[model samples]
Target chain A: MKLAEAVAALSLEVEDPQILDREVEGGYCSDLLSDVMAKAAGGSIWVTNQVHANVVAVASLIDAAAVIIAGGMQPEEETVKKAQDVGIPLLSTSLSAFDVVGRLYELGLRGTLRDG
Target chain B: MPDVKDVGALMSVTYDVAARDFVRAGEAASKLKRLLQQLGLDPAVIRRAAIAAYEAEMNIVIHSYGGQIKVDITPESIEMICEDSGPGIPDIEKALQEGYSTATEEIREMGFGAGMGLPNIQRSADQFRIESTVGEGTCLQVTILHEAGE
Candidate 1:
């Protein structure tokens, strides 16, 4: 699904709108940056509670479609700037990580490597 | 004793990593990734190099007092050396085991200290070496070769 569509489906707050048009191939949920770096597939939407500039770096390195900061977390200002600079959408939602993952799964978003 | 002729012109840059500074932990790795991209290295090679650098950088930030990461990029390979003055690991073998972490609750909440740092870095590099002294510090050297035949 398109990132913009997924954002609307989940009621996520758009932190950066420039990236909403990118296509999302899958979803990955992890708080550990290293886990995402090693395992998350490119073009996947990364769902996590991590709110830091490093999250932006991980998203860029893995070529993630976007980042959804679950639990209504607010990232540092620098993180928002980094996301904008990299042109990756940074998003947030009031739902917990588990809930966000569940909703995305219901919306046909599977894990990057899982077979639906 | 390998032939030095295999090595090409080298470019090096160093970055200082401050301990417990979660805010700036991955800056070195991010910059290194950009440098590798600008050099037109293969995407897979750049990803591996960047992941290794980032994991090492996080280790220094979580476990050390402070340290520096030095990166040397060449046509043949990318090499990273991270050295930090901090509480060195007492048992390297145990520390290398996945899921064994000494990170505090604060660090855990920051999404790290799951004991995957060193292991992940090792997996990302072609050659990895780690040295530590109980009271002194720890040093890691990682090398990632560019795409084979490139």
Candidate 2:
């Protein structure tokens, strides 16, 4: 699915719309940057509540499709700047991380396994 | 035949990592990633190098007073040297175990300090080495080789 469709389907606020057309292969939810760095697939969407610049770094490193900051968390200015600079779409939702993950799963977004 | 000296060239860059600076922790790794990408390296190799560097960078930020990370990339492989000055790990074996950590509450709140940094670094690198002394500091060296095919 395209990031745009996922955003609309989950009612996520598009903090950066520049990358809405990027392809979303699947989803991986984690707050730990290392886990995301070591496991997230190239085109997967990352669902997490961690709103920091490192999050952007991990997303860019693993080539994650986009980052969805859950629980209505507002990212720091630097975090948003980094995401925009790296051309990764950053989204936010009022729901909790679990809720967001559940909704994305229901929307047919599977988790990209580490080896797969 | 071409000059033997021209067979391989080494490029090195160094960045300073500040302790407890969560905001700037990943800058060094990000720069390294950009450099690797511009060099036309394989994407998987670049990702592995970036992950190892980032993990080392975060360890310095979370545990040490401060440190320096120097990345030396050659035609054959990428090597990262991370040296920090602070209290050192007393037991390397214990520290390498998953889920064993000495991180403070503050660091844990940032979603790091989960006892995965070193393990993740080791997993990401083709070669890894570590040395430390109590009340002094720690040094980590990680290398990721370019695969034979690429």
Candidate 3:
């Protein structure tokens, strides 16, 4: 699913200019960095309420396609800019992390067969 | 992929993980992930490598003074050696238990030091080894297999 499409489907208002409509292959929701790093499938869209710069860094490290800041949270300026610099689209929504993740899953965005 | 018997086919990479710097903790793992991608490793192997490297990286940041993770990859498998020179784990058995951690309040606020680092590493690697001294340091060896056709 395209990121724009997902955002629209979720009825989320995209406040950040850095968001682009890249295809989101899958979705993983977690606030624990270790779990995310260990278990997040590649090319998956990440949904979390954590707004720290390290969250951006972890998403990039795990090769997550994009990051959605759930619960209407906006990241710090440095975090947003870093996401832009890394070419990873960042989004925000009022939905809780689980709600967004459930929406993605209900839309048939499930686990992907990650390729090299 | 190159044959393991061919020594020239072996590729090795090392990353230094600093301690107590929560901001820079996951940098080494991120670099390793990028290298794995550039090398065109299998996604499964890449994931395993990421998990191992991440746990090792977290250990350095939360527990030890500092450490280094050295990865040697071949067509057959990837071998990792993580060495730390910080205050070692006094009770390996207790430390191995899930939900057991000695992290400070400051560390917990950052959403880490949950005591899952070692267990995550063990779960991710095909083979695992750990050694530590109470006042000295710690070392871990992890190996993950990439069997034929995997």
Share of native interface contacts recovered by each model:
0.68, 0.73, 0.43
Candidate 1: CAPRI quality band: medium
Which model, 1 or 3, shows the larger lDDT? 1
> CA lDDT of each candidate?
0.85, 0.86, 0.78
Across A1-116, the per-residue lDDT of candidate 2 in tens digits comes to 88898899988888776669988999999987778888887899999988888888888878889999999899889999888888888899899999998988998999996651
Clashes of 1: 0
lDDT of 1 by residue, A63-88 (tens): 89999999978888988988998888
Residue B4 in candidate 2, Cα distance off native in Å = 22
Lowest lDDT sum, 10 consecutive residues, model 3 chain A, at A12-21
Better of 1 and 2 by lDDT: 2
Chain A vs native chain A, TM-score per candidate = 0.95, 0.95, 0.85
Worst 10 residues of 1 chain A by lDDT: A107-116
Among all windows of 10 consecutive residues in model 3 chain B, the one with the lowest summed lDDT is B1-10
Off by over 4 Å in 2: B1-8, B148-150
* lDDT (Cα, tens digit) per residue for candidate 2, span B13-129: 888899988877787888888888988998888888888888898999989999998888888888889999999999999998887889988777778988888998888888899
TM-score of 3: 0.84
Clashing pairs in 3: none
TM-score, candidate 1, is 0.89
Error of 3 at A92 (Å): 1.7
Alpha-carbon DockQ of candidate 1: 0.52
Could you give candidate 3's per-residue lDDT for residues B10-111 as a string of tens digits? 888778887877566667777777777888887777777787888788888778888888888887788899999988988999988977889898776666
